[model samples]
Target: MFDMIIKNAKLRNAKDLVNIAIKNGLVKAIERNIEGKAIKEIDAMGNLVTPPFCDPHLHLDAALSVGDPRYNMSGTLLEGIQIWGERKPNLTKEIIKKNAIEAIKWEVANGTLKIRTHADVCDPRLLCVEALLEVKEEMKDLVDIQIVAFPQDGIYAYKNGDKLLEEALKMGADVVGGIPHNELTREDGVKDIEYVFELANKYNRLIDVHCDETGDDQSRFVEVMAKLTIDNDMEGLVTASHTTAMHNYNNDYAFKLIGILKRAQMNIITNPFDNSVLQNRTDGYPRRRGHTRVDEMLNRGINVCIGHDSIMDPWYPLGKGSMLQGANLLMHYAHLSGYDQIYELYDMITNYSAKTLGISNEYGIEVGKPADMIILNAKDEMDAIRLMSECLYVLRKGKVVSQTKPSISEVIFNGKRENIDFIVER
Candidate 1:
């Protein structure tokens, strides 16, 4: 007896299909054939079944706020920030909660069951923090949400910014976040990292900083973060998101910093969707890379993950709330198109992201792990990314939370009607 049984499922990279038995909200058995009777059963039909996707970085508070007061005229990061600042004052608790929940629903529909969202806490009112806390609790059954107390303006540059972030943590924000690269001075940026590390230590929380997100080669705050992480013995608990500046760093400096990142066990999160547009805004000409050295870091065995970062927000005007879309973009941006590298891209959104969120223990679909997974229309990871494959079924705790059909197209070929499945055959 089981809660649900999924048959003929193609687990990632597996050559043969296997039956999965779910019981007591956990995966009870997985084998070639299983004797089972359950209230519900799923026929995967040799489609890919993977652990639900996890997005470790997103701004829920600012989601769906594109062109609210005005559009980003310059299409630059600074302009986007200014537009977001204008919209912040008029935001109410009701508005934030409504928009965030809608964004969460979009992600869930795309098979993202776990997320780490940054709630802006630069305002003394802490409106975004309050709103997202409520969303986290209300949506607990629908998704696992971890709220980060993000100081968007600057922890040290903005007056009382540090205090407001602390208040958000006191009000139950899960992770500590900061933006060191945006500070007024290089010294201020250093202090920003120090303060973020101090607060993270004080609160016994994890750190996720927007460090060196700019294209300027001199924005070297990521080194400061790594050093502080090592000195504080907080290795593996710190993450530096959007280190796009690393792409402009010289080979020697970049190599040295990568070593330090390895020693600190710091997680690096590259937001392809947001940074691909935001970075290199100030560049005049020549080869200007907007992202970090992802291929090099992946080759170095550093724990690098991907983030969507923005969704129809001021920073990014386009988003369909799909991690596969993000990964597909990354596959091109990071030059990860080889057969093995394509498989690795799938891990970036799931396993690597789970590592960033510190949820590896309960994040997978193995036996004894929670029965939370998604059945994709694609038979493998390559098709999943190539087609942005629809998730036919999404389950949480052994229950079907969402289900849908993949798009199909019909056309007359040689006087006979045929279907386009979009399956790239070998």
Candidate 2:
């Protein structure tokens, strides 16, 4: 017998309705009409159904902790980092776990089933890493949380920072992370990349670093990371988050860098919302957008993903962990508004983000894949993005994990219009 069946779902690319049958946590079959009975059946009402969303970049340790130690009065990255440094000393496992769990629940409720979060490992206590590790195990049934052992402070700036990173991996971090641009010197920035690569190789873990997250054109750590990835043959396994310097690089330099990035096959993640606020602080007139070369990167065939990066955290004070909102803002700022480009923007938050997280095989809606998907109250992909559709139902492994009813309203404009009720089903 089938475990569950969803009837009359409008898939992302399909023009007609189809019924999906789930068995033993995997999609068993997809057809115009499913014949066999199941333990549970749901009528989708011809709503759009597709794979669950994936948020490839976030900070679990700092998530939902805005204004804890103190509000970011300056609203700058450096001030936020300083505030975080102050707050880290007071963090405990209970506090960290409580906030992290709350954030994960918010994400699941919003239809994000997969996430890659950076846990600050600069502190020797390792409270963030330990808390996130436990949270990952506890939330395994609802969400897949990949923790990166990140040194929010520079790896070389903090005492025994390298040792702390190793300890975090030993405690079960999924990826190696660093802040190369924050290092003391250019030499230290280069050395930080080497250290991250070595540790990733030694532990057989994935690499994701905060490379050149500033507007300074001299922040060239991204090149160092790309070269190391190519030399070490670690393509697809390495991700460089927030290469904001790419926006400031001269066209000639950027063109040269593109070749290196293509050769390495490394992924790029841009946080349009956060960077838009934090960057361009020093500019007066006609300021820059503080985003990466998304258009250029896409044209060059270098994998690029968009991320929320933060939600109500010190770095970014406003966000709801919604990938749709992220996609909307990114599409506008990145100037990707063409008919096909809009669809590609959707992929940045879904398929491409999954690839960045190394979860492509387990993230789609194909047969034999895990039954993780969301039902949107929209007729098609374009409508979904246009309306910012709400997830009426979210299923994880054939089981309903979260759901919400759409809002309905009745209004009378005038006697000529008459009184009519409008049901807003999401």
Candidate 3:
């Protein structure tokens, strides 16, 4: 009498075997034992079933375009920018759409069903925005793709940058984005934040700024972002990504900014994989960690999330479009080794990230919510992270979209035959 039924699922907040019932395209019921039949049924086999992953910060315009013109031999953010600049001019709409869809396929298969992708709108052709807008419509049913009209070049640096950004918004971009630290000066950076907020308010769209992604402590545009968010009453509607500069700020200034961030109720997204490698290239001997205060932010009750910023893009040469990998990297970079912290890390990739994208109400595994979730091979949160567990099933709109079978290997050593699975037990 339902759409689908999932049995023997291991829910995070439950102890006994939980069953889920789906009707229409939403979750109908969730309890210890669900009755009734459905068109389709899946046995979870006691695997962890949680909400689908959401990546709040990703660059789809330049995804999988590494070394198009040349490699970033310098291994610095500036050089990567230069390389991307060289590659962008040669991008056509078809090319961008093809690669962007390919990248989306990779992410969707990996259980990241919702994403906020930034498209560079500084080009005169606006090819990236056009391509992503089309992709947004093309992939609407399978996944939720929100396009951010990102000005890779400073909004004030180029003569018609502001015009180009507005043009993209008029073309149906969903969010307003900016890179303030790349501006010509600190004052220009602050002004860029204002321009972004103004456009966000004008269009009534979400705001996601690449604020202070550099390693310099003076790149403090996050403070201005927080102030604008608070003064404009846009709390919980704005997100600041890749604020790696906070790692270099003094304790006094850092704590002061934290208070403002808390007051603003703004979201923070840290790209652990890319920021750890792209930043801190200029320092010698005692190099910086080049990551934001993620642990501290979580402790302060700020909505913090993790993202796979680049997938073989100019900024980061190596990425597999996996959110679990991103969370594992964050666990190592931010020293989140405590038992509770690891569970929090898992939430960063799933629930908290959904909040950052402003899609929490329709996400998560609860009755009366949309059934968008994934079943992983692991039994618990820490086990999932430790094994980078395989997603056995991915459901969207109460329908199965992807499924993977776990691998098993037979070992014959010293005349002893043993079976081995991903989880090794003594």
Candidate 4:
């Protein structure tokens, strides 16, 4: 007998309805008109059934910490950093684990099952690192967590910050992280990138840097990262998150940088929701959007992913840990609205984000893969994005983790009864 069976669901490319059977936390079969007696079965009612979302960039340590030290009145990146600094000292294991667990619950409830979180390692105590490590284990059955030893305060700026990063990796960080643009000087920033490569090589960890997260035209650490990736031949293992400076760079320089990035096979993550608010603070009129060259990067064959960086945190002070919301804002802000472009945008949160986290091999909804997927109350890809579709059911490892219901309303119009379930087919 099957452990669970999902019936009458619309898969990604199948022409007709299919039934997915799961047993022992693995997708056993996906066939038409399958006869099975399972412990549980869900009728999808012709809604879309696809893989769960993958959030490649987020700060779990800082998540759910809004208004703790104080609200960000200036609405600038530096102000947010200051606020986070004031709040970081009081971080205990219990408090960090509580907030991190709460954030993961929000993500799982919204159909996000995989996340790459940046844990701040600027403090010598490594309290955030240790707490998040515990949180990772606690939530492993429901979510896949990849922690990065993030030096939010700048690796070279803080005393023994580099050592702290190594310690975090030793303690069990999946990736090595850096914030080079936040360093004291350009030289120091470059040095930090070198140190990141060294640490990753030393620990055999992945490299994901908060590179060039500023709007300054001179912040060229992303280029440096790309060059380093190429020089070290670490293709696909390096990700440059929030390269907002690419939007401000002159075409001459950016055009050249894009080629280098393409050659390096580096991945780019644009947090449109948070970056649009945090960046370009010093600008006056004709302000910039404070995002990376997503279109250009994709055109050059570079993998670009989108992420919800902050969730009601000090950075932007508002978020819900939903990748759909992130994809929606990104489509509008990046002007990716074409039919094909919208489909690609969908991949940004699902497949491409998995690629960014280096977890594509274990993600997706195909048979024989891990039975982690979500059923949405929408008909097609566009319908999901257009409605910001709620996940009717989220299954992690073939177990139901969260569920929501679609609303139906009937109204009498012009002496006729009308029913609306907001189901749109494309």
Best by TM-score: 1
Residue 417, model 1: Cα distance from true site in angstroms? 0.8
Worst 10-residue lDDT window, candidate 4: 417-426
**Per-residue lDDT for 255-362 in model 1, tens only?**
999998999999999999988888898787775868988888888888999899999989999997899999999999878899988988899999999999999988
Off by over 4 Å in 2: 415-426
Taking all chains together, each candidate's TM-score versus the true structure is 0.98, 0.96, 0.98, 0.97
Residue 276 accuracy (lDDT) in model 4: 84
**Global lDDT of each candidate:** 0.91, 0.89, 0.90, 0.90
TM-score, structure 1 vs. true: 0.98
* Model 4 Cα shift for residue 121 (angstroms): 0.6
Sort by lDDT, best first.
Answer: 1, 4, 3, 2
- Per-residue lDDT of model 2, residues 2-44, tens digit only: 9999999999888899999999999999999888999999888
Model 2, clash count?
A: 0
Task: Judging by lDDT against the true structure, name the best candidate.
Answer: 1
True-structure Cα RMSD, model 4: 1.5
